[model samples]
Structures are given as C-alpha cells and as structure tokens.
Target: MPEAPPLATEHLTRVVDGQTLVADVSIEVRAEEVFVVFGPSGSGKSSLLRLLNRLDEPTGGTVYLDGTDYRTIDPRTLRRRVGWVPQRPTLIEGTVAENVAWGPTLRDEPVDEARLHELLDRLGLSGFADRDADRLSGGEAQRVAIARTLFNDPDVVLLDEPASSLDAAAADRVESLLADVMAAYALTAVLVTHDADRARRLGHRGVRLHDGGGVATGSLDALLSG
Candidate 1:
C-alpha cells in the first residue's frame, strides 16, 4: 500500500478583514519532495504556508499532518513537527548557537549540542556557533535561521520566500543549501517563491496561486510553462 502523504489540505480558506487570502486550496504533498508554491505577490503564497504551519488560523477548511487533523494538535507541538522559516532572517540578539538552540530550549528540552553542530555544518556555517548573530551577512544570517528551524528536528519545513531578501548570488547559495538540507534530512518541504526557475529546479510538483486561489497544480514544468 502507498504510504499516506506527510501533509495535505482540503478546502483550505483564509480571510482577513473581508479580504480572502487563501481560497479553498487543497493539495497532497508527498514525503521527501519539494512542493513549490509559486505566484505573484498578494496571491496568498505566504498565506498558505502560514496556514499549513498554523501560524494563522483558517476561516475555513482543514489541514492534515501525518493523516491527523492539525487543528487537534497542540500549536507548539504542531509547530515543532512542522517547522517554519520566514522570508527574512530574524535572529535574536545572541550568538548563533543560542538562536539555533532556541526551539528546544523553549520546551525545557536540553539542546542537542551534536545536532546543533551538525545543522550549522550542513548550512555551511561551521565554526560559527559562537559568533554573534548580528555580525553575520544576509546570506550567513539566513543560513543561521535555517539551521535554527532544523534544530527542532521537524518532519516538514515550510519556507516563505526564504531567499527573497538576498542578492542573486546569495539567493543561489540559499537555494543550494535548502536542496542539500532537504536531501540530507529526507524532509518534506513546501517552498514559496516568485522565481519560476527556482520553482522548476527545486520542485517536483507545485501549485500556482492567483487571488488567493489555486489556479494550477501539477508537475512544476507544466505549471510554470505558461
């Protein structure tokens, strides 16, 4: 029998102050694959990511993680299992290690030093553990932010314009880093990006959002070809 997908949504909708941000969007994301969310600004690409992560409440519909309704799960637990990295790197005022270890620390769990180092190394930030986070460049800080999310050992990772804040070179680096990390962890990922080439390179399948509704869903190539 085929295993259930790690994540799925049914008739997901989100409205804010009479504005519909996401409209009845549904998708099943296969395990260990990159599921791209591509669209123009204000199309609810980020809104969908937030809904999946439960950062924002949906006005209607449902989200499932591992065949269980996400709303039934504790928000903190759900967030830990399904990690999130925003469009911008928001490192706390502290060392890189502190930021990376923040997640486990919140739950009174002991930070795994070995795992922390592993994540930093994977993100190409080795030897940066003790470095002050504010001192790092955009690319480096973004890498740290990624490592921070990974430290939680999430089953799925939601990235909202992860590289949008970086320059061309830095964006490429972040993209490469994400691909490598996803492979290393065998993670299920949902990435929101405006770059069509990026969607093709990283996504096996995807959905394009328009006016908070899903306009297309299929193999990335076909979705982006138009």
Candidate 2:
C-alpha cells in the first residue's frame, strides 16, 4: 500500500445560496512540495483553500489531512495544524512579537523564543520583533504572517494569492523567503495564484480550476502559452 498524501480533497464542492463556487475538486498534495492552484478570477481557488481548513464547510466531499477527515477534528485544533495565510495578512493590534506569539499562546504553550527568532531570522524579521506589527511594509507584513504561521509548527499551509499586492522586488523577496522556509521545514503547501510566472518560479505540481473542474496540469511554458 502507498503512504497517504499530506493533503487530499475528494470530490470537494462548495455552494452558497444555490450558487456553486467550487464543484468536485479532487487532488492529492504530496509531502514537502508546493502545489500551486491557478485559475481565472472567479475560479473558486480561494474557496477551495477555505474548504481544506474547514473555514467554510464543503457542500459535499471530504478534506483529509494525513488520511483523517478534517470534519472529525475540532475546528480550532484543525486550523492550528493547517494554517491559512491570505493575500492581505491581518495582524493583531500589537508588536510583531505579540502577533507571532499568539499562535502558541492559544494552546497554552510557552513561547519558544529560540525557534521564534530562528524563523524570524529566515524571514528577515529578527530586529523587527519589538517593532509594531502595523508599521510593516506590504512585503514585511506578509513575511511576518508566514513566520507567525511557522511558530505553530503547522503540518500544512494554505496560501491564497500570497504576493498579489506587492511590487516585483518585494514579491520576489517574499517568494525567496518562502522557498527557503519550505525547504528548511519540509512543509507541504497549496498556493492559489493567478500568475503563471510566479507559479513556475515556485516549481511544483499544480492544478488549474475552471468552473470548479480542475485540470491536473502545470508547466511554466505551457501555462504561459495558455
């Protein structure tokens, strides 16, 4: 028998007010690989990520993390394990340190300062620990959001248009940081993006969503030509 995938969605569907946003999305995300999800504006890529974390319940189908259905687990506990980072990160009203510490704090776990600093170091946020979280630039905020998610030691991370709002330079820096962290931690992730170039640079398996039916394909050149 084969080992279970790190993340799997089986015939997933999401509907709101009789409108179908995502229909029958099924895919297996392998371990330690970045799986990019690309599609048009209303292709339901974001909806799929929300369904994986159970932030939005699927109208039908199942999301399995490590082969166990997510619906059977506590929502809060599942979220901590399966972290989601939005395009525009939302930080709490406090210093950067406080925001990063919030994750472990929720579980009554003592802050792991060494590990925090280590992850912050990777994110270029070592010195900004005591700085105000609200004072960060667009790219810096995204980096901070990523570091905060890492603090919880999540098994899987979901990224929705992670660098959609950043400039070229800033976005490149953020992507570089992610590549480094993902490699170092061996993290498994699914990222939603409209940029085929960005998806190519990330270099992984991918799927394109159209009308909720996913095409199991991704090749930078092919995507660019399409």
Candidate 3:
C-alpha cells in the first residue's frame, strides 16, 4: 500500500461573520506533493490553508499533521513545524539575510549559513543576502518570503497565493520556484490559488471550493475546466 500523506483534514469546517466559510473538507497531502486549493475570491481557500497550519482553528473537526492532531500541538511548535507564506509578503525592515534567519533565530537554533545560502540560491535570490528586504520588487519579495519559510526547515509549507501579486512572467517564475523547492526539500505543500491555469501547470491534485464549502476533489484540469 502507498504511504500515508503528510497532512490530512477530517470533516473540517469553519464559520465566520455568522456564515460558513468551509465545510466537511477532507483531503490528504503527500510528502513532496503540491496540493492546491482552487476557488474564486472569498471561497475559503485561504481559510482552509490557515486551518492546516493552525493559524485558524476549525469551527468543527480536526487537522492532522504527521498523524497528530494539530489543535493538541502547541501553536508555536506547530507553526514552526509548518511554515506559512502569505498572499501578500510582509517584510520586516532588515537585510534579506536577517529576514530569512528570523525563523531559526526565534527557535533558538543556531543560524545555518550554508542552508540559508542554499535556499537563497534555490529561490533565485543569490545576491540578495545583504540587500534590504523592504527594497525588493513584489516578485523578489515573494521569493524571499518563501526562502524565509524554508529557513526553518519545516516538514510542510502553507502558501496562500504565493504568485498572485506577480505579473505573468514573474508568476511563471514563482510557480517554477515552488515546484523545485518542494521537490528538493521533500516538503508537503498546501497552496491556495485563484488561477486555474497556474493550478493545472503545477500538476497536482486539486481540492475545489465553492459557496464556502468543498465542492469537489480531482485533477486540476478536471476540476477547473469542468
């Protein structure tokens, strides 16, 4: 039998502002696999991603990470174990290196310069270490955000529209970078995206959301073009 996936959600549900945002969602994300949540605006894609990493608690049901219930895990520890890259990259006023090192620093882990350099190179920010993170372009900053998330060496990465802010060319670059990073790190990834074509190009199974609930589960092509 195949090995179990790295992350799973069972009967997950969430409600906000007196309305349901996600309901009865269950899915598995395997190691080194890119699992994408696709939907239109306000369809609860981001909320679902947040639930996986425990950034948002479910109104009902549970999230499992590596076979453990996420809610039972300490928030700080769970967050460190599961990295998150938000839709809009928020950069602290600091050198790129400082921003990337922030996660490890918080965990009291000695900075791994080699790993830091490697991630920067892998994410195409090779010469950006000393540059101000606040000075980067949207695409560049998004890449830096990814690098920062990987710096902690988490088992899973949650990406909420990592490429949504980029132009067509830059978005393409972000997608390629994400694929490479996931493979190289053997990390489980859950991404929230609105672009159907980008979701197809990522070549991952997709979970579709509509009307604040999971509508279907299938290949990106089947779900998006259907």
Query: lDDT of each model, Cα atoms only?
Result: 0.92, 0.87, 0.86
- Candidate 2 to truth, TM: 0.95
Q: Which ten residues in a row have the lowest lDDT in candidate 3?
A: 1-10
Question: Number of clashing pairs, model 2?
Answer: 0
- Tens-place lDDT per residue, model 3, 4-27, is 567899999998878988888998
Worst window of 10 by summed lDDT in candidate 1: 103-112
lDDT of 1 by residue, 14-52 (tens): 988999999999999999999999999988999999999
Q: On a 0 to 1 TM-score scale, where does candidate 3 land against the true structure?
A: 0.94
lDDT of 2 by residue, 74-189 (tens): 99989988998899999998988888899878778899888888888988787988999889999999999998888888889999888888999999999999988889999999
Q: Which candidate achieves the best lDDT against the true structure? A: 1
Instruction: Tell me the deviation in Å of residue 1 in model 3.
Output: 9.1
* Residue 97 CA displacement from its true place in model 3, Å: 0.6
Query: How does each model score on TM-score?
Result: 0.97, 0.95, 0.94
Off by over 4 Å in 3: 1-3
- Assess candidate 1 and give its TM-score to the true structure: 0.97
